[model samples]
Target: SGCDTQTVVNNNGSTEYGLFQINNKIWCRDNHIPHSRDICGISCDKFLDDDLTDDIMCVKKILDNV
Candidate 1:
C-alpha cells in the first residue's frame, strides 16, 4: 500500500502520479498533453499531497468505473 507520490515519467511518454500511480493518459491529465479522459474530475496534482482524502475518493471513482 505504500507508494511514492512524486511524478514519474514512463518510457512510453506517459506519467504516473501519487500513491495509486494514476496514469495521465487515462485517469488524470498532464498539462502538456492535449487530451485526457480525467474520469476522476480532478487534476493529477491533487493526488500528490500527503493527505489522501481526495486521492481515496478518486480511487473509489475509478474502482466504480471498473
Candidate 2:
C-alpha cells in the first residue's frame, strides 16, 4: 500500500497525494475547494516536495492527533 511522493490516487471524488498519501478532502485543501480541515496547516503543494521536512512535520501532527 506504499506510494511515492508524486503518486496521486482518486478516492471516489476526492484526491490523495504525496508519499504519505494525504487526502485533499481532510488534511489538505485546494484553493477553490471548501470545508477542508487542513489540520496540517500547510498547503498540499508543500507535501509534494522531495525535501520531506514539511511532510514529516505534518505527519507528526497527524500522528499526534491519533
Candidate 3:
C-alpha cells in the first residue's frame, strides 16, 4: 500500500522528528524521518531493552507490515 500523509513528532520536546498517526485503530507511519535520526517504534525487540532514542531506525517496523 502507498503512504497517505505524514505527521511530525517532537519526542519529549526534543529535536526528534518522526512521522506517524493513529487512525481507524491503526498506528500509521512514524517520522518518515531519515533513518539516521529518531528511534522508531514499530516492533518490539524482546531481546533488547528498547532504550532506543528518537534518533534511531525502526527497521523492524518496516519489515513487520511489509
Candidate 4:
C-alpha cells in the first residue's frame, strides 16, 4: 500500500492507515475520531508517512498486547 493510504472501515469514522492498516480507534490518534485511543502511543498520521519503522513498532506493540 502507499505510505499515505487510508481506508474508512465503518460509518463511524474509524479508519486504517498505511500498509498494516492500523486502526485509529485503538492503535493511534486521529482528530476525526472522537474517541480514539493511542495504545501504540503514536499519531495516526505518522503511519501515513513513507517510514515503516514506527509502523512496525506499533504493530509489535499491538501484538504484545494481544
Which model scores highest in lDDT?
Answer: 4
lDDT of 1 by residue, 1-66 (tens): 267788888898888889988878778776955598888777889878898998888888889988
Q: Could you tell me which residue pairs clash in candidate 4?
A: none
Model 3 regions more than 4 Å off: 1-57
Instruction: Give the winner by lDDT: 2 or 3.
Output: 2
Residue 48, candidate 4: C-alpha displacement in angstroms: 0.9
The candidates, ranked best first by TM-score, are: 1, 4, 2, 3
lDDT of 4: 0.83
| Model 4 lDDT per residue over 1-66, tens place | 454456547676688888889999999987877677789988888887778999999999999988
Predictions: Cα RMSD each: 1.6, 2.0, 12.6, 2.3
Rank candidates, lDDT, best first: 4, 1, 2, 3
**What lDDT would each prediction earn against the true structure?**
0.82, 0.76, 0.30, 0.83
Best TM-score among the predictions, by candidate number: 1
- In model 3, what are the clashing residue pairs, if there are any? 18-31, 19-30, 19-31, 38-54, 38-55, 38-56, 39-54, 39-55, 39-56
lDDT agreement of model 1 with the native: 0.82
Worst ten in a row by lDDT for model 2: 1-10
